[model samples]
Target chain A: MTGVVSPMAAPAALRGAGAWKPAELLFWTLPVIGWFAFPENLPLLTQIAITALFALSLDLVLGVAGMVTLGHAAFFGVGAYAAGMLPAYLGIGDPLLGLVAAAAAAALAGALTSPLMLRGSGLSQLMVSVGINAMLYEAANKATEVTGGVDGLPGVENTPLFGMWSFDLYGRTAYVYAVVVLLLLFWMARRVVRSPFGVSLRGIRLNAARMPALGVPVNRRLAVVWTLAAAYAGVAGALLTQTTQFVSINVLGFDRSAEVLLILILGGAGHLYGALVGAVAYMSIHHLLADIDPEFWQFWIGLIFIVVVLFARDGALGAAARIRDLIRNLILGRGASR
Target chain B: MTILFDGIASGMLLFLISSGLSVTLGLMGIINLAHGAFAMLGGYVCVVALDRYGIPFPVAVLMATLSAAAAGVALERLVYRRLYGAGQLDQVLFSIGLIFVSMALARWLFGPQPQPIRLPGWLQGQVQLPWIEIGVYRAFLIVLGLVVAVTLHRAVGVTRFGARLRAAVDRPAVARGLGIDVDRVFVVAFAIGSALAGLGGAVGVELLGLDPSFPLRYLVYFLIVVVVGGSGSFEGSLVASVLIGIFDVAGKYYVPQVGSFIIYTVMVVMLIVRPQGLFGRPSP
Candidate 1:
């Protein structure tokens, strides 16, 4: 909580506080480029987008708000179930409607659980989050008739995007749809994290006890951010369900929660773009490693985690920054000597 | 009647497995999520010895315990020693990483299937008690668990090593000033905790099942024991483990559909009511 480097050191435009820079614009365009450049890999690209969004949501909680959680998948699963159930049970297949329902359901869950999270110390908070997740997983597992149990909810057919672009086999439509949602949500998140409210969140994260003395409603702010993060995660989950037309209990699994947290950390926490970078790196590595040996990929991932924690500490981005500083210092020192 | 007996028996097994975790978390302030991996390792060792090498059950259990302790010592010296002053997040991530590595290693060694073990004839079959018959293995587990518990209690309460350990944990600087090797005490405590986990794994294999996913599967239960018992409180873990075991068994028996939902709900409620846990000191 104390050592989280703020995103202020990022280049001004990348901080998302001013007019968009060409690099910022180009970053979003890469997904669009991938849509055309790698048509066959659209499915994987789409998954990467969804996972990035999920990681972004986690960053808001763990990175910005400084809350450590292992149960964020509870919100993701809630959103997924909401979206999936809408089409299967209620015959509402509108993608936009599904997104809304998912967000609301997930946000509601966050609101309900935030009190518990707010009451405990870091260790207790971790335990409470985990406990909540286990309860939800068990509940979902037991509600076979409604959730389709372990077999996963079937017959989730969504209406065409805007009643025009039908999802095709090659996943072109799903890919575009997912990227668009990610862009919109990412844009909103960027704004929120740069706002005064966002600044206050950093303050609370740094020193919660002193924030209340400054007249900041510490618990209320945390509750709001936690809910907002849940909504973002819910949207990610909704996109997953819409693209795949499947909702399995695995969405709520502990692995998903752990995976997303790792993704955020691997990219670098507290930096908005780090989530995006981390997700892409993680999924790509996962894809390549799994191809080489499906079962042993975890071993490599574990090794990476250990190395990262021991050396990089701040993740991939942090390591890059350190190398950059080292080169710059070396050049400056040589110039001064000369 | 049978349900109660079964609940207590299973509870005893739970205490054995989680007692190690409680010790580490309470005394060392390390959230060792990989504790279950050590348990799994012991179970695998015991299984391979008894099934493949034709080793006797008792000797296999002893070997399992020793191996796990050795692994614990190695990890402590190599990895955990550096993480003592790190944040909870780093410790958590590190242990989780260890879990993944151990899991993959287990899959490679054991082929992703639940390991099978053959209990000796003496430990097999039902034992007649005056009113009810109980599985001999379960009865043995209860006796073993109690013996370990009492011995551990006395060791921590009466022995000079225990006094040094308590001194080191409560006031590290003062203990070091008093010529106590705090680091050595921690290493010993960690090994002892891991040995207990191994012992639990060897004996509880038939009941809990052994597989690559064993660590992740039983992680929550161990965590529950540590958290609810309050970190650093030995008796608290015992009480919490027994309560959770009974609840888990009764829930599965009476409401098979709900399964573990009941216990999870209870845990959540307990946490909400007492975030510091049943016997823990209030957070600073």
Candidate 2:
């Protein structure tokens, strides 16, 4: 609690490196460059983009707002179901409308559940979050008429980008669509984290008890941010459903929540870009390792998780910044060149 | 009436399974997710000893518990010792990693499905009561659960170790000045807790359904028992488990469609009603 970097310490390295600045030109253009470089891996890249967005939403609560949620997948699953249902059952393939409905649905779920989270501490909170997620999973599983249950909701057809470009098998449109959505959400998140309200969320995260004395309405702020984050996560889930054209019960599983949380931590939470970088690195490494031995990959991933928590204080992004700072200080002298 | 009996029987096992975790969680503030893994290990150990080596069931339970206790001691010395002062999340992550390692090892060694075990004749049949009937194994479980819970409660609530732990937790410097072996107490308590978990796992395997994924599957249930019952309170955990056990059992029997909902509802309602748990210690 004392020495460990609080999840809210915005990593200056990633903020500088990930932002769309002239020096960090690659941050904005990487997807475009990646589109050209890894032509065959568009589908994987699209998945990475969607997962990155989901992790980003978690950072708002876990990092910026200091809520340790194990049930964040509830929003994602809700979004996926809501979005997929439109095209599958309602015959409405309008991607934008589906995305809105998904976000709205998830936001409502978050608003309702956020109050339940506010009552407990540590283990109680952890159990509640897990409990809520499990409840949602059960709800989704039982609501077979809508969710299609174990078989998963099928027949989701995308209406194309603004009614122009349809989703293609080569994943060209899907990749572009996912990237655009991620960038928009990433920019919006950046705005939210830098605003006055975001700073209040930070104050609450650092010390919620003291914040109310300073006149910050802690519960309201937390609920608001939580709802917003849920909306963002829902959109990400919708993006996945829209591009992949499928939604499964696995979306609501504990594994999905855990993996996204791990990805956020791996990227070094707090910073907006931590999610994106963490998602890319984790997914890629997982992809590589999983391919090597499908049966035993969880062992390696678990090992990675342990090693990351033990050795890497801030995760890969956090560690990378420290290394960069060390090199800069050695070359330019401490506090000399900046 | 039968449902009530079954609920009480199941509740007893829940108490046994969670008491160790509840103690360690409150006293040490260590979020050891691997707690269930130790329970799973105990089950597998009991199964192996009973099936392959032809050990009697009761003896095998003792062996399984001791083995798990030994593992806990080794783990405490080797890994957990370094982590005593670490962040709470770090502890959770570390223990989770350990559980995953154990799970993989179990799969590699024992293969995928739940290890098979056959109950002996005396422990297999049901005994009819005035209004209801209960399995002999369930009766054994209730006895085992009561004995362990009472022993633990007495040991932690009335014994010298309890006083020493309280002193240490309250005023470490003063306790140390008084020559209390705080470290030894911690080690002993941790070992006992692990043994209890192992014993519970071994005994409850048939009821809870053990397999390689045992830890992950039953983690929520264990946590619910500890947190909902209120950490650091033996009485609290006992009460919570009985209530939960009855609700869960009765839910499945009566409202087959919404069984999980019943449990989740209890957890949510409990948290709202008592955020610190029914008898949880006020946060330090």
Candidate 3:
């Protein structure tokens, strides 16, 4: 109850409330470039964009705030079911309003669950977070009248984007719409991560005990960030429902929670872009491996998790940094080793 | 009355499954998410023995327990040993990998179906009493659970090994200086924990049902028990299991609609009231 705190520190590159690097902007630009290059794979790219947004939301709490969450999909699932169900049941087809409502609903849910989570030790907090997720999932399972039980909720309708650019069969509208939201959120995430609030979050991640001594309201900050992260994830989920017009019980599953965690770890958390990078890699591998066998794909993902944990401390970003260092050392005389 | 019996019986099974994980986590400071995999392995072993071969239920149960404990020892040596002092995330990642691999193995070996279990005639019927109607298997489960609980309580609470193991976990350097083989204690404790989980699985198949998802499905139950009982306390696990078991059974029987939501709600409320669990002492 008292001292189950995480000891992970925010990496230096993300600690400063600073200006965006040119390279970071270029990183966001690459997806748009890919959109133009691969016209036939817009659907796949849309899915990736949505997933990257989900992972980015996770990075806020996990990497930036230092919370070890395992049930984030609760917010995501809640948002999806709400948005998807609303349009079908309540006759609200406007996608913009749906997105706002979904984010608010998820944020509300996150606020309710945060106090319970904040009271426990690290592991217990993890258990409680997961426990809430299970409860939400079970609720969805039983509320068959609305959720359609195990058969899944179908026939959610999305109105045209701002009265223009309707979704077509080729998925062009969906990809463009999703990417715009993603870029806006990604920009916001960058700003938040570089804000003074984000700097304090980094401090809390490193040492919550020390932060309270330094006049920071540690638990309050965590709760706020938790709620914020939940909203981000909710919007991401709404995006999925908005784009695909499908929401299944699987949305609230433990697998989704676990997969999102893996994506964050793979992309090398703490930075805003890690989620984007990791999602692209993870979803690509996921897409590629599903061609062979679905069950076995998880086996490879698991192996990737192991490798990332053991060798890549910061995940893909960490590995890329190491590779860059090696090449630099080869090119230069490895002066100062930095 | 019948509800109480079923709850206590189910709770006992949960305790047995999580007992190893609780003790090992307390003693080793590692979260073995793959613990349920061993339980599934036990169920598979028992099923293969009974279905593929003609082994008796009792013998198959014994074989399953031993084999599971043996697997625990091997994994502890080869895999888990390296993560003795590792971060929780690392431990989680590594054990999660084991889970995926075990799931694949189960599917490959068992062909993605719930393994069939045949109880003996004595265990297959019901015992109709004036006060309560009980399945013979439920009665036996209650008895077995009580016996295991008492035995484990004695082994961990009163025995010399228990005293040493406590010391080893609490103060490894001092315990080593005092001539305690910390490594040996960990290995033995881990083995016992795995064996108990296997025994639980072997006995629980008739009630809980076993499929490829068995490990992941029941994993939360085991975790709730270990966590709510206090990470390393057998007595705590026993109490939590009974409470959760009855709560779950009653919820299902009475509400039906809520099912596990009731249990999870209780978990949240309980955690809010006692974040360290009802019995868990705050760690330094």
RMSD of each: 4.7, 4.9, 4.6
What is the C-alpha lDDT profile of model 3 across B150-253, one tens digit per residue?
Answer: 89888988999989988988899999999999899989988988898788888888888888778778777877887788877778888999999999998899
lDDT for each residue of candidate 3 in A1-338, tens digit (9 for 90 to 100): 12223345545765563665555555667778978899999999999999999999999999899998889899999889878978999999899899999999999999988898798867888889878998899899999998987888889988888988778889999999889999998888878777657778999999888998867789988898899889999998898898889888988988788889888877667866668877888898889987888767667766677666666654334564464344334433342132
- Candidate 2's C-alpha runs over 4 A off are A1-20, A314-338
lDDT of 2 at B16: 93
Full-model lDDT for every candidate = 0.86, 0.82, 0.82
Q: Model 3 off-target regions past 4 Å?
A: A1-17, A314-338
TM-score of 1: 0.94
Q: How would you encode candidate 2's per-residue C-alpha lDDT over B1-284 as one tens digit per residue?
A: 87887898899999998888876776666787788988988999999888898899999899989988988888887777667778666676677777777877788788788777776677899888886777899889888888988898898889988888778766767999999986776777778779888999999878998788988878778888888878778888888888889999999999887757778778888888888888887676
TM-scores vs. true structure, each candidate:
0.94, 0.92, 0.93
Q: In model 3 chain A, which range of ten residues has the least summed lDDT? A: A329-338
* Docking quality class, candidate 3: medium
**Model 2, span A256-315: residue lDDT tens:** 887887788776678766787788888998899889987777887777667666666543
For each candidate, report its DockQ versus the true two-chain complex.
0.79, 0.56, 0.59
Q: Return the interface RMSD of model 1.
A: 0.9
Task: Report i-RMS for every model.
Answer: 0.9, 1.7, 1.6
Cα deviation of B207, candidate 1, in Å: 0.4
For candidate 1, give the lDDT of residue B51: 94
Candidate 2 scores a chain A TM-score of 0.88
lDDT of 1 by residue, B1-284 (tens): 77777888898899999988877877678988899999998999999999999999999999999999999999999988888888888888888889899999999988998988899999999978899999888889888878887888788878999999889888899999999999999999999989989999998899999999999999999999888988877677888888888888988999899999988888888888998788877765
